[model samples]
Every structure is written in structure tokens, then in C-alpha cells.
Target: MFLSEPKTLTTSRGTFSYREGGSGAPVVMIHGWPESSYCWEHLGRHLKQGLRVIAPDLRGLGDSERTEGQEHYRKQELAKDVISMLDELGIEKFQLVGHDWGGIVAQEVALAIPDQIRKMVIMNIALINNLKGNMEVIEKVRSGSGKAYWYQHFQQAPGLAEAMIPGAEETWLRFFLQGWSNDIPEDSIAEYVRMYRIPGTPGAGANYYRAFADDAKRWGTLSDHVWKIPSLYIYGNKDRVIIPEYLNHIEDCFEEIRVEEVDAGHFLQEEKPEEVAGHMNGFFETD
Candidate 1:
């Protein structure tokens, strides 16, 4: 994504495509839904000089091969694909960065191998399981999310969101990209539109939302688990769906957390790349 060609690796799950750039401590960057590794293009440029940016197109999203089954979209299952890919790539341990769905998957990866990640940075999304039994947070998020997360319900299970994507691909894609952010990257958006034009890609994207139930249940088993890893969370204060209130009780889940709230929308990195990268570089200690 950062002026590097996309590389392919075959795993049991499917053929995954990723971009690798720079050389130093490895930093795996995971992108969120409706956008591929290309979304990291801007942010990766700044850190690539001092860090190895490994940005993978989540299965069925970018240049990666789409695997069958709705279960594949579940964040835990997606995390497995990432771990296996890293193992095969011969990366022992590394830092992590994730946005949107990637943020959720990054949590799964951290939880699965707390010892492997030197530091973790997550943006835009909140890990709900961390909230556990806090009724106030639980109630607030449920009501607030109901209005914001209406698309989740539409995309989950025999949802109609994917059906709408086939003919009006750009319309559906931009619905989130343009609406969720104050500034939209035209190049990245054009690339995303081209990718979604592929047959079956829309369904693959929708399946991610379809696995909400499975993701919740999987994280439920770790309802009491709290990560002690020094972590940084980048919050987009103006996010329409994942409102700022999600920031409440976040400290309860992490032993040490540094939250940087940006005056942007859900796609904070895209809206404010230079500033976002600055926050990340400072937290990650990269000059």
C-alpha cells in the first residue's frame, strides 16, 4: 500500500494478499471493512521508514482470495488467518495497529498472544467484551448503537445490505466512506470501488457483519479477561456509528491505555493521516 507491490501467501484459510514495506521492527497493520490495505497507504508512508508495515487485505476484501462460509468473517476466525500468516512469514513477535473491524481483530490477536505484541494501537472501534458487566456502559452503548449500527442488523444473517451492493456498488461503498468521514480519499475510494465490482466480494464483505453473534459469543468466554499490554486507542470523536461514549469504561479493560481523541469521523486515519500517524509514532516510540 505504501508504494510496495502486493504479495501473496497461501494459508489453509485462503490465499491472502499483503503489502510489506520498510525494514526494522515489524508492525502489522490491519484495515477495517469496506476498505482494503490500501486504506493504510497514507498512514504507512510516514512510519515505513523506521518500521516494517505489513498491511494485509482481509480475506475476501482486497486482492486476497475470498474463502467460503459466513464463519470466516467472524473476527476470531479472521484473527486466526492473521496469526497463521505471520507464523508462516517467519515473524516471531511484532507491534500491531488496527482500524474498524481490524481494531476488533487486533484485540483478538492481542488476547490470543498477549506476549507476542510489543505494543498495540487500535482506532475507531471499542472492544465491548471489555465492558463485561458494567450496566451503565452496556445500556448506553446498546441504545446509542441502535441508531448508529443500523447497518449491522441489515448486513447480519439473511441481511439485505449485500443485495443492494451488486448493482449500485459505488453507491453502497461510498455510503459509508463519504458519510463516515469528513474527508474522503478519492484514490483509495476509487480503488475500493474497483475491488467491490468483483463478483462475490459484496457478499464476503456483508458476511463480516453476519458473524456478529459468533464474535460476541467467542469474546464472551473471555468476559473477564483484561489486557495489561501498554496499548493506545485512537478515537474519532465525531464518528457517527461508534459514538464517543464508547470511550467510557475503556480504561477498565486495559492495564495501561492512552486514548487520543481526534476531531474526525469514523475514518480518522483517512481524515487526518499526518496527525494520526504522529499520535501512532509517538505512542509506538518511532522517530
Candidate 2:
């Protein structure tokens, strides 16, 4: 039986899918790339005991309707989707939590509409401010067997999408799920794969990275925004995709920043859900 109700929302652009539960101050949870709102199933169950949780699958992922065009993959454009979702739901202000690419969207959302966000908890990603000078990490991951992590570079090339369509979902899912969790039930993988198979999703996922350069140029020097609200940053000590060191400068960016390193990997929420949830709840309880 499901712990929450999965709802489909009609936004200005398309139909977005989300799972919501609990009943308190609103807390919006955004899932990261190659994953869906289901990523927060476990964490949201814990959070729901005290707070209302809305976990949404961004466009092209999970039950959300898939769309064509590279413009949909841009962070700025993606952030607008969240804004529209909030407006559609009649939520004026709420707390935010996001992981991976979803974290990037959360940052942009905070920057674009600070009035709508009361506080934020980010897991497994550095602030857009930290994206500055991260090309070295990009090149490093792209250099060796890690080339798969940089698949977006290839997807950006003409005809690569057609080349990747076959078995792309399974291959990518297996690549990221390694050691993410020993307890991930069989159904979880099935749920992820179901969404992964959605038409045009593979291209949309890769396009997120393909458009990174453009996003960097458009939101240059994040120091101006510097996250003024209360914030918490949680990272997996073993996260291979996004190095933990890049977050070194985050303290200087947010005035009331709290940072914690957990003993897990890139999929921290899955690898160490209890720890991450505990830290998140404690932080949210604070003023």
C-alpha cells in the first residue's frame, strides 16, 4: 500500500506528477536527475509525520509528461516549472529540499523568487556559486571510465539521442545505482525503470548537462544572490559524481549555513536515509 497519494498536476507547460502526504507547514521536495519523485518516498514518509511533503517529478521524469526541445532542460526554465507548480497548488510560501539536479533547480527557484521560499535544505549538490570553476571536475569525470557520467557531452552531438535510445535507461540506471543502497527493494528499481523508459526522457535527462554551459553563462557569478535564507547542506562523503570539496566555499556564501557530511555516496538519500532525515528535521525545527 502507498503511504502517500500520487497526484498529477496540470501546469501551464504540461502535466507534472507528484506524491504528497502529511499536513503542516508546506515542504516541497524535488528529486534529482535520472530519478523521480519516488526518490523521496522513504525520506518523505519520515518527514510527513510532522510536515506536509510534496515531492514532484520534474518534466520528462517519472509520471510527469515528457516534452521535446532543449529549452525545457535549462535550469532557469526548469525553475519556472516549480514556480508554476506552486502557484497551481495555491501555495504562496514553503520550505524547499532538493537533491542533485533538483538542487540546482532549488537554487534557481530561491534566487528567482526568494519571497516564496522560507528555508532550504540541499542534499548532494553544491550551490550555483560553487559551479564556478568546476570544469576541472567535469573533465576529470569525463576523462576515464567515468566517461559515462559525462554522457551529456555526447548527447549534445547530433544523432546521439537516436544512438542512445536502445537500452539507455537500463544502462544509465545501473551505472548510478551501484552501492547507492543495499536495501533498495526490487519494486524501487522497477518504479525508476518505468519512468526511465518514458519516450524522450533519456534525451531530456542528458540535455540537463548539455545545457550546463549555457546556464553558467546566464547565471554568472552567483555571489550576488548568496542564499540569504536559513539553509542546510548535506553531502555524502563518498559521492563520486559530485565531489564534496566543491562545497568548501559554501560557508562563505550563506550567512546561516549548516553543513554535514554523511557516510554514503552520490545517492545519499538512499544510502543513508535515516541520517539525512534526522539532520534535515533537526535543521527544519530551528528558527
Candidate 3:
């Protein structure tokens, strides 16, 4: 039986809804913005054949409780939610995988408890410091030279996003789902729309962007921090949201890292689950 059923855990911060399946070593999978643990269903099914898989809806997203303040959505606090969830489950160690915004949270979780994470895989995101200060990256985003992350700027506009997004949530979300991938299943898109339409979800999603500056500051302060565990970064060559060029900055952040480029877009796992799962399996099996 694939353990994709929803399960909830009450942590000190709030209740977190997650899915658990398989029966071997644990693998915690985290989803990014505009998505939930449901995004990992395909990948989880693939991994659950040989490893335990846990996919959680981050606080205020999916089925998780909507946190009280925007501060609760900060990357550090989000990372804490994952840590606390594991502690409550009595899981002391596990492998980690995160995509997009989840990739950022995974970095914080690994950094917070390096000893507990056996290995990590970050997909479709550039984990680097001084994001705001990186003029080159800023120029790429601002100039629309390669990939323009216009949503990052728009979401940071406080009350504006909440005002404009709710009524047209499906339209707004389809823009990302279609724009970022070569192909995504219609059912997956519908699922995301249904979940985001839940009350308080739009504001909760926007809070992630609202806390960008603080996230940048935290990464900036940890600029010299080097990742001790083995890490793998998978990038989609056609990812319009996060271009392949961003990988240029990731080399210094990890002590030992390997990069692989796939022929997909931002949502590579969905676009190419077998390939993504193959890479993950090979990477995780290594010493």
C-alpha cells in the first residue's frame, strides 16, 4: 500500500499535515511555493518502494494550520517546523529532499542539524547568500535577460498580492504551472488550485515572499558556512523560474557537491519523475 494518505501531527508551533509511506530508511521531502506535499506523490511512490518517505505540508499551506503571523512563515521558522515535526515523531536522522522554496527550507534544516541529516538533495533552486546584494542576479531578474522572476517582486508588495490574487487564484496559479514546465498533468494543476483556494492560503503563500528580506539576511550572515554532508543539486535546463546560470553561485556553499542538468523545466520532478527519482536513488545510496 502506498502511504499517501494524509496524517497530522501537532507540533509546538502548530499542527502539520504530512504523508508517510514505505518501510526502510526515512526520506523527508519538502515542496516549494504554490505547492503542497501532494507535489511529491509521484516521487514518493517511486521512492517508497525502497525507502520510507515523509512529505509534509508546510505551515499555512496545504492542509496545515494557518499560522498566526507572517513571521511564522520565515524560512528559519519553517525549517523549525520540519525539525520539530521530526522530533515529535522521534526521528533522529533522515535524508532530505526539497524543491523550489522547499529547497531553501532544506538548507536551513540541514544547517540547523547537520549531524542529523545523512545527506541532502536540492532541486530547481539556487541556494546562495546575499541574494539581494547579488547585482548580477538582480540584473538578470530585473532586465528580463534570461528568466524573469516577476512574482518575487510582486509578492513582496505587502497588501497588493493578497488583494489581486484571491479572486483569480486558478488563473494566477496556472500561469506558473504552465509557464514553468514543459508539461504538467491537468489533475495536478487542479489539485493545486483547489488547495490554494482554501481560506487564508493566498495570504499564507504571499508571506513566503514577504519574508524574503529576512531570509536573505540570514543566508548573508552565513555566507562562510560550508555544507559538510554530501549534496546533489539537480537543475532543469529549461527552468524559466530559476535559470541554470544560478548554479554558478552554488559551488562555494557546499564542501562536496555535484550538479546534474536535466531536459525539463522548473518542476523537473513532475516533468521527469523517473529521471529525478533515479538521480535521487543513486545519490542517496552513495556512502
lDDT of each: 0.82, 0.76, 0.82
- Models 1 onward score TM values of 0.93, 0.90, 0.93
TM-score of 3: 0.93
Q: Mind giving the per-residue lDDT tens digits that candidate 3 earns over 1-287?
A: 45576789998888989988777788889999889887876665565255888888998787898865688888989999999999998888799999999998998899889999998999987675524325456666667654366687787787777788887989999999888896777767887898888888888898998888887777777766778889999888997767655776677777889988899989988888778888887877432
RMSD over all Cα atoms, model 3: 2.3
Which of candidates 2 and 3 is the stronger one according to lDDT? Answer: 3
Clashing pairs in 2: none
Stretches off by above 4 angstroms in model 2 are 1-5, 131-148, 179-183
Clashing pairs in 3: none
Candidate 2 matches the true fold with a TM-score of 0.90
Q: Which stretches of candidate 1 lie over 4 Å from their true place?
A: 132-138, 141-145, 157-159, 285-287
CA error at residue 206 for candidate 3, angstroms: 0.4
lDDT of 1 by residue, 1-287 (tens): 46477789987767898888878888899999889888888877776357888888888898888766898888988898899889879887799999999999998888788899989999988674565443455587666546666777777748375567688888888889999997778998998998898888988888898888787777667657777889999988888777655676787788888999899998888889988988988877443
* Tens digit of per-residue lDDT, candidate 2, span 171-253: 66776676543555456677888777877777777777777878878766664556788999898887766775567567767
**When superposed on Cα atoms, how far off is each prediction in RMSD?**
2.1, 2.6, 2.3
